[model samples]
Target chain A: MSDTTIKPRIEKAPVLERITTALPIALVPVLAVLGFVAIGDPAAWLTLTVAGLAMGLMIFIMASGLTVVFGLMDVINFGHGAFISVGAFVGFSILIWLGGWTASSSVFLNLAAVFLAILVSMVATGLMGYAFERVIVMPVYGQHLKQILVTMGGLIVAQQLIHVFWGPDEIHVARPESLRGSIVIGEAAIEKYRLVAVGIGVALFLAMRHVLKSTKIGLLVRAGVENGEMVEALGYRIRRLFLIVFMVGSALAGLGGVMWGLYQETITAHMGSEIMVLVFIVVIIGGLGSVEGCFIGALLVGLLSNYTAFLAPKVALVSTIALMVIILMWRPQGLYPVVKAK
Target chain B: MKEPLLTLSGVHTHIGPYHILQGVDLVVPKGGVSVLLGRNGAGKTTTLRTIMGLWQASEGTILFEGQDITKLPTPEISRAGIAFVPEDMGIFTDLTVAENMTLAAARGPLDPDRLEWIKTLFPPIRTFWESSAGTLSGGQKQMLSVARAIIEPRKLILIDEPTKGLAPAIIKAMSDALLELKETDTTILLVEQNFSMASAVGDTVSVMDDGHIVHAGEMAELAGDARMQERLMGLSLEAHQ
Candidate 1:
């Protein structure tokens, strides 16, 4: 061959996935330190810090399902909030029925009542999620615009159904007697309910991380989220996986609803929709379809929301949105984008 | 053709309004590499996809083991023992290399012997067994893609453009790997543009043009005949070399 012979150009193999970045993980602690420095008062700062952790964890629980569903199915489900409202109602109603134990001083009674509420709520919302997928989301698969409109309609219908079942008036859901007060540690006080929320949130995060990392089903899920078509091509039914994921996501939303209701001591048909603003922000900020990203995004938002509210009340109103904008400006695809192999 | 393992009879595939594959008729004999060669946009990829059931055949029948599978869904078609490695390689970048193979071994756990053999074949697979697939280079990902397809005992493997964009050294390695796989009596239907590798590994060759099979013959015949090569592929074999 002559030296002048044209040869096919060779491309150097890329060292890493395009979206890999260590920055998102560091942002959580960086935000904490920033919070500490900005607030200046140790007691107030510590109190806000715990509140932020609790809030961030709850959002992570809610956003986790949506992110995975978004990743695996490529289906935009605006109706996810309905599961939250239904979950809150279902859980709190179970609590109300156990009225005999609501005022009981025993910690077992309090925990039992709460546990029962969570169980029933998950089951209820899980079933609802199944029906919603079959009846609503299934038809609009791969059609993003239609998915948005139809799922939004589903949300409206769910909200109205909630009103029909529970009445139009907002309901007050008080924490169980044992979970009603706070423990004072030095100069700062932490609500008993908030502490419980923190423990549950962290434990749940670990469990989810373990499942995604070590389990076969979790492997399929991560793969399906990245490329459902490829998953199907590999001899696995992705549609069934999508249905299972949707149901689980709905159940998690229900669980979050119950905890959120207890945390706020209030339940209403509109509560889920209201919280969804933060949930969307977190999903967007934590690259869509990654539970870890969702968790990190939730923490950043929670801390910033709390800190900004303390520092500048007006900025607090749009703090999560502002954070989302800034994060997007930095990483257009968000932190830890689960890129489909192209 | 040594008792065909797969037969596509006048198969037509449509992706939305685009009629990509227009009545493709081909036979893939058992126990060899059957390379599908075509120019860009000639519907070679669509033919493989139609057989895999990724895109449904709007018309005609696809038969494997004498069973009609044209209307089958992708998963059912795969469960019937067909594995596809798309041009993109379809590696789940977020998943670990081991996790990727585990997912492909649908029937049961990965056989230790089989895994060891595969690890030896592709060292990066063993070295990065626990690392995210994203960490691997392009050539390594392609190796994993083929490895995943054969992780379990598949009846046939379909690979699209495996050597599409790679260094010459990697191309030689891939060609050798395909030849080694042939030793085990595995059937591979490869859609490849790299003529040198295709001729080196292919036992049977089908040339496609404008969604139709223009010629099918022994790989050696096509490789030895420069006139036939120009007529079928519109390029001389020497240029590819």
Candidate 2:
């Protein structure tokens, strides 16, 4: 209370910190501008930007859960892709069963089919996640090497099971008539479904942020990420909190799976494994446990991939890796590293 | 003089290959401060941790209100009206002070009057309520750690090295705060290295050496007798001065 008392070393002004935080978000537009300059075509640029945004949002949905799980549990679950694939297949089955709803020209019926698919997929994947944690992840709490091996084995088994059930061949999925077309604005054309994906992605991000920042469970989770022992000492069951987080994370991956499957208009047993590469890239670029970092990292990868594919089709595959390297050189701990005591 | 609120009898703990706690017998009496003192690696920390069930006692019993609690989980131990502030202070640096305090009030929402009382005890908890705890000074974080333990009333509070690595001014402030806490009905089992701080707030004292209690008696008697302090702690109060 004394004025002469030494102040706890004054941290950088909050405004400066805010600006640094906002800097990554600014990169999206800056990259978009660079794309416009390189292509020298306004219409193509507009189309690619929307496509990139949609792609980024979907990747965010998938990577968000992985980062949270890693951040809090310190578990590297290599089999997360299993949930994605399972959700896609389960959701696809429901869609096929609701043929009447998908075939209907009415928007309400078409939306209803997609909603049901998302709901069923989330539930199925969430339950799968519970079993996965109890069976494969619980025993190897602090053993990183075993976690990687067991989870990878789990992925392989899940993929094979998909083949056994859905057959070895790729299955074609048709979009509902209501969602199949694009809306034209001047010279730029944007797909309606991609716009819808963008809406859903933003909604999910806001909801997650609100929950993590405002709720008691979110507080415990964030605290658990820093020190699980402390949370337990404070009389909360950190294990139960982690289990709930793992299930929710798996459910989100499922929702992302349904969205991505629809975007590709094709479902295959190996689709989740295939996307795992990109998801891991997003997770690494985002910083291990930070949701905001994951969101920005996803968008950056999305835009870079789209822009590179447009400008130089051959370099598209390595664009994300290249970007990650450059980013790492600039900030070794990823774009927004959570400051945790080592 | 008062009945022991908690009692640990012949507790032994094994952490991996190291038998850290050979046998720790401690008694925390009701409604006063009891200081646990010893040199580094004396198993002082292991004793507190065992009571909180962070490290399970391999042998012997821990009783609370004469009920066996030797095998309860850490959360269960805490829920049974005991709070532990670990040696590291255990402040979640990523979270705001308010969030850390909120999590510690495990029973429910913080009582408004209690929150106000805590704010007066530790001003930084209120002053930096919205700032992430990582930004706090070592002393402020220590205050927040103690504030968290008393966020709600508990039968016993276990605090380990609350003044470690803090400035002298801050240590005095912490000592004063603990002295104030001594006036309340809360029972504190404190682990301390600073003799001045220990003698300032301690009602009773237990000294450990190589994982066992070597001496136990009234704090006033030990503080007044230089020969006893030297024999038990290898250093007297005057030596620190």
Candidate number of the best TM-score: 2
Global lDDT of model 1: 0.89
How does candidate 2 fare on TM-score? 0.97
lDDT of 1 by residue, B17-114 (tens): 89888889999999999999999999998998999998889999999988999899999999999999999999988788888999999889999999
Candidate 2 lDDT over A170-259, as tens digits, reads 888888779998999889999999998899999999999999899999898788888899999999988898899999999999999999
What is the C-alpha lDDT profile of model 1 across A248-297, one tens digit per residue?
Answer: 99999999999999988889998898999999999999888888989999
Alpha-carbon runs more than 4 Å astray in model 2? A1-18, A339-342
Q: Model 1: runs farther than 4 Å from truth?
A: A1-20, A339-342
- Deviation of model 2 at A328, angstroms: 1.4
Complex DockQ, candidate 2: 0.64
TM-score of the A-chain for all models: 0.93, 0.95
